[model samples]
Target: MKIAMWSGPRNLSTAMMYAFGNRADFAAWDEPFYAAYLKRTGIDHPMRDEIIAQHDADSVSVSAQIAGPVPDGKEHWYMKHMGIHMEDTPLDWAEDCVNVHLIRHPARVIASYAAKRENPSFWDIGFQQQLEIFERFPGPVIDSADIRRDPEGMLRKLCIAIGLEFDPAMLSWQAGPRDFDGVWAAHWYGSVHKSTGFAGAEGALPELQDEAAKLVAQAMPFYAKLAESKLA
Candidate 1:
């Protein structure tokens, strides 16, 4: 099965990628559209010029690389993508794959992102935009909180959606470094690699400033809308 995993920034998308990539039968590709999006929109992404300088904003080439055939006859392939990527022009590559949308509480997500000195960008906004995106897509959408709360159950549901039987093997994966992960792994997910199970608490990251908190509060309606949609 070809599966595309979509999520917002700092929403455990990378760690989830690690879990799926751990499977010997799965091949994973990380954040391939970002360079292209940055270039095409001419938006100021955090690593803007750096990424464009390296990849030259060639999304077609990047899309090709992302959709390239897999090796070892892996039955499943996964690609990690950010939700903000869905725009006026959708990727033709995602047309036939099973899509899994991962969403998190905006308060926690934005707070976590701000703690890391990360900019929220337009992608961080909750509600109408995000809700519309989720509702338009026909696929399984998993709440990040639920995934963390019940990894096993959620994984089974995910497997079922893609026409695969639940493999107890996916419940837990051995943690380690592997190729196919983005270079940002070392910086963003260092603590995740060392964890054996879910890291219960949202660690002691810096608190969001009042201004940021207010902004997140304003986005709560959208978050609530998403929570409702996922439950529905």
Candidate 2:
């Protein structure tokens, strides 16, 4: 089985990737289309040049690769994807995979993203884009908060939804990096590298500036729509 677990940044996506990576039957991929997104938008993200040079920048090639066979003949393939990465890419290719949407509250997402990018907008947080993909290709939606609150329960539900057996190995992993991590891991994966499993819930919601708050407000409806369908 091939699973496309789509999520926005700062949404426990890396932790989820770690969970799946710990499974012996699964081959995990981290943001396979990130380089293509950077190439298409010319966004000056950290390690931009190296990222673009390191990964395939053609959307068609990337999509084909994502739908291709599992690496090393693993039984399951778990792909960690950013919804915004599909901004200009085609979606039909992904229909073959079991898609899972991971969501987080907009206010928390905005605050967390701002710390990294300083000026995150709706697109940066990916709520609208996530909604679009969810609509185009309906799938299971899991909230980051829900996962953090009950890691095992949520993961079990996710596994059942995707027709995979739940493995206790998904609960913890060695604290470090893996060979499959993207080159950009140095910049974005510090917290995840230090984590062995899903961390506890964060503190109170962060206070956002007026502009950032407005962006969150704009994203809340979409988040709400998806949240309504999230696993209990």
Candidate 3:
């Protein structure tokens, strides 16, 4: 089976990727369309040149790669994708794979993202794009907070939802990067690369600035709708 776990920035996506990568039966992919997104949007992200040079920049080719075979003939493929990356890309191909939505509270996402990119907009945070994908191809939605609070419990529910047996290996992984990491890992994966397992729940949410507060307000409704369908 091919499973696509869709998430926005600052979510537990990398940790989830590590979980699936630990499974012997699964071949994991990290943001396969990132280069394509950067190329299409000409966004001046860190490592922009290298990322475009290292991976296929065409959305069509990247989509084909995702729909293609699991590497090394693995029994299953687990791909970690950013919802915003699919903004200009087609979605029909995704129908062939099991799509999983990974969400985080907008406040948390905005805070974390703002630390890296100043003055982030709704598009950068990806809540709207995530909602669009969920509407187009509905699937299981798992909150990052839920997984962090109870990794095994939530992951078991997720596995059952996706028709896969929950493996204990999903609980932790060796700290550091893996082959499946995208070329932009240097820019975005610092904390994740140091993590051996999901971090515990954070303390009180940080206060958002006026602009960010407005963005969060805009995202909350979409988040609430998806959260309603999240795994218990």
Candidate 4:
């Protein structure tokens, strides 16, 4: 099975990827369309040039690569994708995959993202794009907060919802980068690379001020649209 796990940046996405990648039966891909997205939009992200040079810069090739094989001969594939990365790519490749949506509270997303990249725009967080994909694929959605609060419990529920068996290996993983990490890992994956498992439950919603607050207001509706169907 090809599991297309869609999420936004700073939303515990890398940790979830690690959880699934830890499973012996699954092979994982990290942000397959990142390079293509960068190349297409010419966005000045950190390591932009390096990422395009190191990875497939063509969305067509990347799409075929993902849809063609279960890498390493694994029984399942877990692909961690950011919705914003789908900007210029077609959804045709995802047709056969078990498309699942991953979400986080907009306030939490904004707070974490702003720390890494200052003044992140609404589009940068990918909430609206995530909702667009949810509408097209119409599959299960899982919240990062729910997963952090009870990793195994929520993951087990996630597995059941997606017609897969729960694997204990999804609970933790070795710290540090994996072979499949995107070249931009050095820029975006610092916190996740150091994590061995999902962090503990988050505290009260952060009180956002100024622009950050407005950004959250823009994202909350999209986030709430998907959160309604997230695995409880």
The C-alpha TM-scores of every prediction are: 0.81, 0.97, 0.97, 0.98
lDDT of 2 by residue, 16-99 (tens): 988998999999988989999999999889899999999888889988887688898899998999998988788887789999
Segments of candidate 2 deviating more than 4 angstroms: none
Tell how far residue 8 is off in model 3, in angstroms: 1.2
Best lDDT goes to which candidate?
4
- Report the lDDT tens digits of candidate 3 across residue range 5-124: 988898888889999999999998888888989989998888999999998888898788877788888999998988999876887778999999999999999999888878888889
Model 3 residue runs over 4 Å out of place are: none
lDDT of the structure predicted as candidate 4: 0.91
> What's every prediction's RMSD, in angstroms?
3.2, 1.1, 1.0, 0.8
Ranking by TM-score: 4, 3, 2, 1
- In order of listing, the candidates' clash counts read 1, 0, 0, 0
lDDT of 3 at 184: 83
- From the highest lDDT down, the ranking of the candidates is 4, 3, 2, 1
Candidate 3, poorest ten consecutive residues by summed lDDT: 201-210
Candidate number with greatest TM-score: 4
Alpha-carbon RMSD, candidate 2 = 1.1
Tens digit of per-residue lDDT, candidate 1, span 109-166: 7776776656664455433455665666657777777777778777777777668777
Model 1 TM-score relative to the real fold? 0.81
